[model samples]
Target: MVDILEKLTIVVKRGKADKNSPYPPDLKGQDGADELTAEALKMGFTPDEVLQKALVKGMHLIGEDFSAGRAFVPEMLMAAKAMKAAMKHIEPFFKSGSVKQKGTVIMGTVQGDLHDIGKNLVAMMIEGAGWKVVDLGSDTSFEKFLAALEEYPDAIVGMSALLTTTMVNMKGITEKIKEVSPKTIVMVGGAPLSQDFCTQIGADFYSPDPQGATEYLDALVKSA
Candidate 1:
């Protein structure tokens, strides 16, 4: 069981999705995250074990490598693809309430931004890290965010903006959210954002990369 879990970790980190997935040449023809996850379940490992031990661990490794410059965006994308393949098998447990998630994350690109690349990537990274992600899509409004918050009171909010002009909107959105739910955690990021900008906007956290964001959230989950 441990060995299968390790293999699942490697396949996910290498971005192998299945026996036919050909993205990572080094892993061609090897059983991928998709297959390994099913095998693990067949081998009697629980869904939570497969999630926390293999899928999350694999993404964490690639994320840390990305943060340290040992990996890059392409690698992260492939890793995410692999994780998604595995998630096809594990998702049912979440719907069944048999596997616990770290927490819910409400993700979106701020209103008027029309940019979703960075936002989508962070959503995938956070989902790979064993959390439930509710994507609000690009050009999201404050009312929609608030509605989602009302539905998921304990969720963390992540906002993205690609334009300098649009980035300014985060300040107002963050203020409104904090005013409504003082305990809600707000995360802001985008190419134009900085730690100082994040502080000025009154957002609770900021990370330049998806991995950094996931790490911070994981720490928060552990502490909680």
Candidate 2:
């Protein structure tokens, strides 16, 4: 398990998707996330083991680097792709109830905001952290959020808005979510958002980047 865990983690962190993936110059032609994950499963490693020990660990390391400025968007995106490749092998187990996730997260770009770059980054980060992500996509309205919340009652909400003009809608959306689900936690982020704005809008948290959101959610899981 230790050997497989480390191998899978390295391939995923290096953004190597499969035997044929050539993105990483050094690891070219080697088994990647796809092949390594499949092999691990065949060897009897549990889905949760692959997720928590490999996929989540690899993504967390990359997220930390991105947060520290040691890595940039391209690195984050690549690592996410590798993580997704590994996920394809384990998703069936999660769906079949063989393993339980850390939690559920509902992500969306606020209404009137069409930008999704930041939202997508955060969703990928959170999903890689081992939580189930339900993305509502860009221009998501309060009603849409409400519908999702109805389906996942205990889900944490994450909202995004990259445009200053459209950001005000976050306040309304947060209010509506709180009105019906007072216990639900709400996190907000984007280029134009700040911790002060998060407080003003009644959101529980705010982050400038995907790594921050990932850490926040991971901490919540630990404290639970």
Return the lDDT, model 2, position 205: 96
lDDT of 2: 0.91
**CA deviation > 4 Å runs, candidate 2:** none
The stretch of ten residues in a row with the least summed lDDT in candidate 1 is 21-30
- TM-score of candidate 1 versus the correct structure, residues matched by position: 0.96
lDDT of 1 by residue, 175-218 (tens): 99999999999999999999999999899999999988998999
Clashes of each: 0, 0
Clashes of 2: 0
Worst 10 residues of 2 by lDDT: 71-80
The candidate scoring highest on lDDT is 1
